[model samples]
Target: MSEMMTRENLTGLYVITDTTRFQRAALVESVSEAIAGGARVVQYRDKSDDVARRREEAAALAELCRRHGRSFIVNDDVALAIEVGADGVHLGRDDAPLTETRARFAAEGLDAIIGVSCYADRLRAERAAAEGADYLAFGAMFPSPTKPHAPGAPAEVLGWARERLGRPVCGIGGITATNVRDLMAHRPDMIAVISEVFAAPDIRAAAEALCHAMAADNTESIQTTEDPETS
Candidate 1:
């Protein structure tokens, strides 16, 4: 794994690929642009049944992320993640059990970064943390076009996870540059975005804007914490 993708370094802009929006070559090109624009983590999310095509795209993306020194994650596909030598896998509620996934990685001599989607459920997040999830994700922070029907997770959940879970918390779904500050105010370690970046007219510019916004918020957070008057 690249030094860029350690458990301690799982912060900043996380971009998830939208296969429905881009084809093979376009996907690679868009991801390259996103990385250039400061996307620290890239996840390949394809729910298609075309196994061969999925493998091909994932392998290409894994290599792309490795070349760019970014974390590469396969969404809900542990086998594909292992086959493509991804840095990790992000599992959702319907995905394989975390224990089994860990065992699979251990058997393969890989220390995989596993992220669990807790949606809007704090109890689920607690359970996942207890089960040793490397990161916990909560979402639909706003109305998400990608998963429009996903459960709404209040911004407060980010704060709760950060203060109590002791794991990297990622705020995902419907995050855009304009409303990201609202989520950032709660102090999530990372923010996951999809259509806002991938479906933009200029992928790099969209990604850069999101990164810049988050950086600005982080700076303000640090300053406020350091200044006694603000406390």
Candidate 2:
């Protein structure tokens, strides 16, 4: 086994699974295609409270990502992530405080891969890094159907983060291959896509396009560099 949650795992195309966009039965299949297409990271985001199904799906996706050598993240639910053996968890500001979450995961003997959503706030990003978050996410940089009212981050958020922090900066929301290059100008370590990747007729092709865009910034080639865990 190789390392997981390393800074090296932060770059490239990130695929977020949207339950609304994919039927339950097809979710795993869709995610598999995404990995095959070149998604470096996979986030299992399900808003529904179907615990049984969520666990089942998350577990399946977790195994799939492991098999493909991709990092798997669970959004907003550390328990579910732990249960599924996911590589990490992504938390919104409204979710459990990072310190608490970290302590809880620590109690379970997990160093947990955690990413914090700072929305449009640079200060919050700074705080999250201080709190020991692995990466900082800012956006709805563009209007997003998934989160229509999500606050907008200024175009310079990524640039500012690069100047201010050494950790990875992930640019998300309404991100697509076509428009991703604009955000890429600031050199985001990751580009997170939902509809652009899952809603496309060909999930693999869509992911490939975004993967290509991610690599344009001299990101790691969309090839073998397994193990999200890092030292």
Candidate 3:
């Protein structure tokens, strides 16, 4: 793990900021609430083409997450991640290659976490791991407001990934307190959320709920594994 994903155990709520819902100023407040509520991971995910605005918002968010001791990531923007001194970058199919990103991080002397979005393709995830990605994210587990047209991934993938990759597997897309159980059944290392955390009326409450769910799920998994009869 390139020091980018500094967490030894990358399990729990991963909050993503939505530009549409949280303005630049409001982004800090909402993200702070998420941090207070126990969100350990945050991603600055803005799809806008406005480089200046993105730089400004991402810088602020990176600083905010740093203050909370959380991993701050830039979505699909290597340049911005480097500029903001982010923990890492999350890349989609359209983004630069994972190998390139890894090499770039090294060249820049930055400890960076390189996360790849596998969507629903297990083969792609396998390839990503082989290529040195720190973590794999798969999602659209349910109907998602963030990516309404995204294809849904089976929860089983999370379990398979955890076993196969031997690294953190993040489940994303429409994950909330209500539907998170399905994903949790697989014991994913993390679950990424956009609107649920940033757009909620009470950001702290929403994040807390998700955090509690993940902790409970992880604890259950540990207990089950350690049980003599189950073993």
Candidate 4:
């Protein structure tokens, strides 16, 4: 694994938001606070069909992430990501094929930080890695009300992916500071959360707390030079 895709560099929390009832300015303010508190990545995942608004929001978040030196990912929308000059794009199982996405990113001269939602099972993750996915996502670990449509992934899947896949692995769905440490035993490359950070009473504090806990528990993977986290 490369340094940019390592777990240590991304040991902190990642926040994803669709539509917050809060005003856009307030949402941006909260996001800024979260970044200051140690959010490594922020993904804008609006499912709305409004192209102009999507482009605008993507641009705004891209600028915010740029200023904070954090990565910005556009979820499930390659065209919008291109329009906003986003740092990366995330794909679901039903989205475009990995080869097509890679080719698109290559054409643009971008690094193509493509993340694949593997849902569950090592087979999917292994396939994604073999196909050149930048990161592999596993879970719905706990019951994720945010994505009830997602299939549940076993806790052991993280360990399997850790041992089997060379690509960075991210555990998502209902991931909180309390349960996140359990995943450390698996040595996944990253953890992705929705309500745990975004829906918290204090987004900034929540993000920082998660980062601190993961940092402490991730000592082994991050400290060992041979571990990909230290790569």
Give the candidate number with the greatest lDDT. Answer: 1
- The per-prediction CA RMSD against the true structure, in angstroms, equals 4.5, 6.8, 4.6, 5.2
What is the Cα-based TM-score of model 2? 0.90
Put down candidate 2 lDDT per residue, 1-231, tens digits, no spaces.
114546578878888998986755699999989989988889999989789999989998888888877888999998998888888899997899999999978888887788999888867888998899988888988999888988888657776776677788898999888878777767778888899988899999999988887677554222222233410
Full-model lDDT, candidate 4:
0.77
Estimate, for each residue in 32-133, the C-alpha lDDT of model 1 and write its tens digit: 999999999899999999898899999999999988888999999888999998999999999999989999999998899999999988788989999899
Looking at model 4, report the run of 10 residues with the lowest lDDT sum. 1-10
Residue 3's lDDT in candidate 1: 45
Candidate 3 Cα RMSD after full superposition onto the native fold (Å): 4.6
> If candidate 1 were superposed on the true structure by all CA atoms, what would the RMSD be?
4.5
Question: Which pairs clash inside model 4?
Answer: none
1-231: candidate 4 lDDT, tens digit per residue:
112433334445777864654336666777787788788888888887777767777788888887777778889988788777776789997899988998887887766588889988566777889898878888988888797877788767777676667677789987889988877767877888878877888888998889888888886442222344422
Where in model 3 is the C-alpha error above 4 Å? 1-9, 221-231
- Alpha-carbon runs more than 4 Å astray in model 1: 1-4, 220-231
Per-model CA lDDT versus the true structure: 0.88, 0.83, 0.83, 0.77
Off by over 4 Å in 4: 1-11, 220-231
Find the 10 residues in a row with the least total lDDT in model 2: 222-231
Clashing pairs in 1: none
How many collisions between residues are there in candidate 1? 0
Better of 2 and 4 by lDDT: 2
